[model samples]
Target: MNLWGRINTLRNQIFLGFMFVMVLVLAAVGLFNYEQVSVLLRSNAEKHIQQTAVQATGKLDVLLRQIDTFTAQVATNANIQRLLMQEADGRPINFEERQLLQQEVRKHEAYTTGIRSIELYTTEYRRLLPLADDTLESRVPDEWISRVDEGKGRLIWLGLDPRYPDVVIAIRHVRLIDRSFSHAGYVMVQIDKSYFELMNAESAADNDRAAREYMGLVDESGQIISSDFPSDIEAAALISRQETISLDGKKYFAVQKQSDTTGWKIIILTPVDYATEGIAVLRTAIIVSVMVGGLLFLILTFILSVMITRPILNLIKAMRNARFGTLKPIPVTSATMEINELNHTYNQMVVSLNELIEVVYQKEIIQSRTELKALQAQINPHFLFNTLEAFYWALDEKGEEELSEIVVAMSGLFRYVISRADEDEWVTVGDELEHAERYLKIMDMRMLDRLSWRIEADDASRCVPIPKLLIQPLVENAILHGVEQRVGQGTVVLRAEPSGRKGYTRIVVTDDGPGMNEDKIRELYAAMESGQNDSAKGNGIGLANVERRLRLYYEAGTNGLNIRSEEAKGTTIAFEIPGEQGRD
Candidate 1:
């Protein structure tokens, strides 16, 4: 067998159909589960990382507040305020006041763990304390002084000291504590960068060090002030505002929290693989389950296909034996009810077929005898045609020309009606029309002025082939039923023309006689379809026979006979036949 034959078999079709349905159901369930779990895992990871960022920012804020307190204490000391008052009065500061100021600054430095230095400068940009590198003018830029003045006694965080390079700095404007609260000088505090590493240490203790998250601190401007992972600072800077980022072909989730005290942000970047570690195990489990289930299902499907097709195959074998004239019945072997019923039905069919064979053989003998009688009957028509020819000659000799033409038409009509056994059932449209015309001529002589007929056909339409005797029956039905019952003179017209449909020609038999109502026409069609002769309605065996022959000869889906009539108007009956190109 070919590929289609193999697939079309009962066994393979059942197996493949079940397998396809099972696989589709499994795939839909598996995909839905995987997506739901993945979303849950990622959501939990994001929430956990967000909490960690908030905690780290809070701790950093507390440390910064402590440094601010220490700076406040030094700036508010009475000795420092008195010294600034003396300097504003144009009195030079003594060596003892300078020593006291230096001691006060060093004293506050001991309060903070990461404090690198504390320095003070006059409004003129001259160093006031920490005289180790004494110079006439301080190295502090005027821009720094302007920014500090804008602080208005509040501490302003300046990320990463440009001069020191190893520390982050804060600057504040020092004001007198007395009633004036006057501007004195500027105070600066620098803290070492190692202080920011506390967050990393705490995170590493909570998680595995190998998969621990990296933390960084950035100023309001997104410039990196300090980070535990110094080498990744550039990548971290680019993604400061993003929740997740990709770098070096690896993905990371970024979490951020901004401090209210220092106006700085703490950023944490956790590797995506570490966060979604559980998803891999779940995916592997699902894949293995699907594979094992598919294999088991395939085996089960094969076994069931065999069980179902075995009995069917046995039935097919018995059918093949019947094809060879064995006429043997099959045994009922299958346990299934439907299959067993099928086997029982087949056995009954085989028994009935044997009986039918005997009956058909007897009928063939009877049909042969009937055909011989039919052959004997065919001789009468030839004898009749010869008698009619003799009558035509006698009438012509007696000066009866009209009656002679009638006799001649009758002779030709009888000859056309007699079909030879070897003659083709189909005839050209022109020949069939000629036969109908002869019949009409004979009827016209009987009716005198009561009936008239006309035929309309183009040359091409007349040459088309159609089943013989088809048009004449339609014409006969119209004249006998339609024109014969009319009160006045009636006209019957036959037209053969192209039907407008491809490869078809239309034949219409129309009569200008008393027509039928819708109900009467419907009843006429119903009688024709049921093969009943409606004698009371004047439509009998002739119309029914023509309708049956048209159906038998024409292809399906093409238009058949269409009858149109009204109570007062004439009736028109039209039907289509295949053209020359459509003929087999």
Candidate 2:
């Protein structure tokens, strides 16, 4: 055939065939490029989040600690006490001394560098200015005085400053400390937004030179202490980024930090577009490259007829068979590892679908987790409360002081069951002792009959906050089932001794009352393991709730309850709860 006739014969097949080959080449290249780009982008994003959170926390800790240290020093200053002493002696500062004292107070304010306002307040409703030439009010606010009333010598952290926006902060009311400390007044200092800038490492520059980022200093109340975001951005309803909030008509990714000393929450916002912008760039690039390649293939359509058409047809057939689970390889296709490997992978995916489908459906898995939390909520609180109310009503009707004390014990029991503190779940052993004492005292008040309770706490466990309400419930439960149920004022001995440094706080509550028999003792063990209720013996929800919270918060191997009982003898409930919810 002539060249023209050959070209005409092949034109229809060749046109589409060459185009198809070009498409294959483009797709393979795009896939390779996409994989590399995606890995790098994901890795970078993850690292950035980890690094920023770590640095921000460290910086904040140092800043807050410095403030605390300075505040402590000022609290104990001799001159502050001297002025307080003179007032105590019914001697007032001479006019010059008053001026010097005022100047000194002003100097302290200046030294603070980040304080917005400072004032001296007296109960006589008198106000004095420390900085004599102050640009703003030197007197205490009406509310500040009310909060500081007679609360001298103690630090009272007040709420946000209503006058300032985003600059809401934590204020401490310290009554003058010491016997000679006069009731002259309290010093109120307003913390400034710039105080947080101390965390910045740069040579202290004008605030304008600070980073062009949205930074905020929050006090314990979770209000913004200050922010670099426009005042308008601050106006957005304070919402967490983990939730969603709109800004400037767009979304943003954000993070939050709750301050340790003040309980303030600091939030940082990044434009949502900024967060997803990288993904958008990669997506756009891939699409554009594929489109450009596809257009280029259109120009090569009129060449390479039979060979190209055969391979392309086989590729489509192979893809179809792989998807349909037929594993139909194109009979006479390209001899290429890449195409064959693609077929192999597709076939394996189909083969494994039965096994992997379970993973894909998360409904049951998530439902179980949710149910576990719900179960905990249901079992712990409900059992304790119902039993306590039952006890309280009995006390009221019978004029039984014994019942009242038991009710009090029951109330404390509930408190401990539910109280999860700000940072730790458990309170200290000493706190446990205090709560247990309250429980026992209420019981003693009720029984009126003498039920003696003794506590022996090791020196170290005094400050260790253990799981809340742990000690009392077991003690009261012992009283209810053992001591009070029997005749006479029962004796309950309480002891907590730290075994070792790893928060090994052991608590034992022993009662001198008729204890359980062998059958009943076995039942108690059964109740614990199965978490079943035993109405005959008083080891109901209080003991169960205490054990559950401790086990939930403490390290598994270290937490549980122990009970020893004898027929017609005494009973003791002993258990070990981690000193501080195992967090410390």
Candidate 3:
């Protein structure tokens, strides 16, 4: 072949094979560099956030513990202990003794000068000797005095300073143990919230000059306890939850630190951008290196003149014959006798191998279909046994009379779910509701007295068509997870109220069980959407499957399912399906 023809031939095979190989090399190097740089930056951001969270919390705890310890010690003091009992027993202190006790309280508060700003709350109850210019109105309310008297020592971290709104802070009440200490009412210590915010921000601000960061001390409720940006601070209080809150387009990695002294949580926020600043430079360098390397390889392939032969032309012709019709024995009558003979023999062997390959392909397809049916079969038997057990429970636990009513309802429900009668999609709402009631009866047997349920359906909604066996799975999830585990008695209410357009129906399902937190509920919905097995930890795949079927079968009826839940409270599951049914 001529030189230009040879170069053109290279384009016909795998895009000049060398360029294809070079692209793969470039992609691999780019991916490796991206991963390493990305991981290092993410790790640094995470560790710095964790470190600052632990440190700021540690200092805050030290400060809080100092107050608690001092308060407890003050409670046990001889004068205060005696005074508390006298007040509890309704006895008045003598004038000579009252003078000595007040002098001692003043001496003790001097030692706590660094820890708290002492404020005298009452004229009759007690006095902060040094801070007292004149007797002031009682800051310790009668309600607080009553709480201490009732023997409630639990100190809660109150979020808002009843008096101060702009300041981010926390507070707690300590019941003085001494008789006079109790009579003194309670002690109020003022803490500086800024001390914590400044200390926390310092550690995360270690790297780049322009990268900005914010520090927040939030309670377990996801409420900001001491943050300059109280509105921006998201609290993950009762549960140690963490989420990224983007502000002005910057990502802040927030870590939660729960305090031991007080039930407050300290969250430290750091800028993720600062940690990965070096990765951008590394990415550019890798791109440049790959381009230079690819050019060098193309030059080498051209110089080598890797074999171009007429012998391969005969081989290509044989390949075309095998594809176009029944495999033919290659021609051997050529001037190049040796090359033609080899091609003929190679063609004959390919005919035998191709026939064998066809046989294996057919067998594998049949086996795969069989295995799929077997998996479907597996789901039914477990379902059968579980159903039988539930019936047995209904009879024994709630009495035989309720059993007959449940059985008749369930028999009709099962007939519809298992039938192959309707090939045309779409079943009535009444049909889906019958299925849902059957599932609820099973759970009602288990919960017995603790279970109660209600279903409301408008006459208009019952005529609306829904995908077969849709509502049953969702009801099963609502009871099994929502109500069954709840401590107190539970209630599940399902409503099929008519909503939106004339033919549309809004179906809602809710339960009062041991509720789930926001994180867990989102996790529940996300897992179902992805078709993952969430059953291991109280997640059921049924709801997700039903959702997929609805979206696929019903072209544009409703957008999606809505799941809302709270921890130890309950959950609400709702979806809007058009009153008119099927995958239209």
State which candidate has the highest TM-score. Answer: 1
In the range 1-584, model 3's lDDT, one tens digit per residue, is 46654544433443556676677667766666665675566665666667666767777877666666655555456775565455446565555555555665556666663433543233245453333444323443355445444544443334434455433322233345533233344444454455345353444455335576565566544556566443643354323454565656777665667777556666655666764466544656567656767666676556434433454665676567777755666664433444555677777687887887889999999999999997786556447646756786777676786775666566655566665434645778887786777777867876778888988997778888777777877777777787777776788888898776676788888898777887887787787789766543555547778778777876586776788777766888888876546444
Q: What is model 3's C-alpha RMSD?
A: 21.6
> In model 3, what is the error at residue 405, expressed in angstroms?
2.3
The Cα local distance difference test for each model comes to 0.77, 0.61, 0.62
* Structural similarity to truth (TM-score) of each candidate: 0.42, 0.35, 0.37
Backbone-clash count (model 1): 0
Model 2, span 328-352: residue lDDT tens: 3333324543445555665576667
* Model 1 accuracy (lDDT, Cα): 0.77
Clash totals, every prediction: 0, 21, 25
Error of 3 at 259 (Å): 84
Query: Candidate 1: lDDT of 521?
Result: 86
Q: Local error of candidate 2 at 58, Å?
A: 3.7
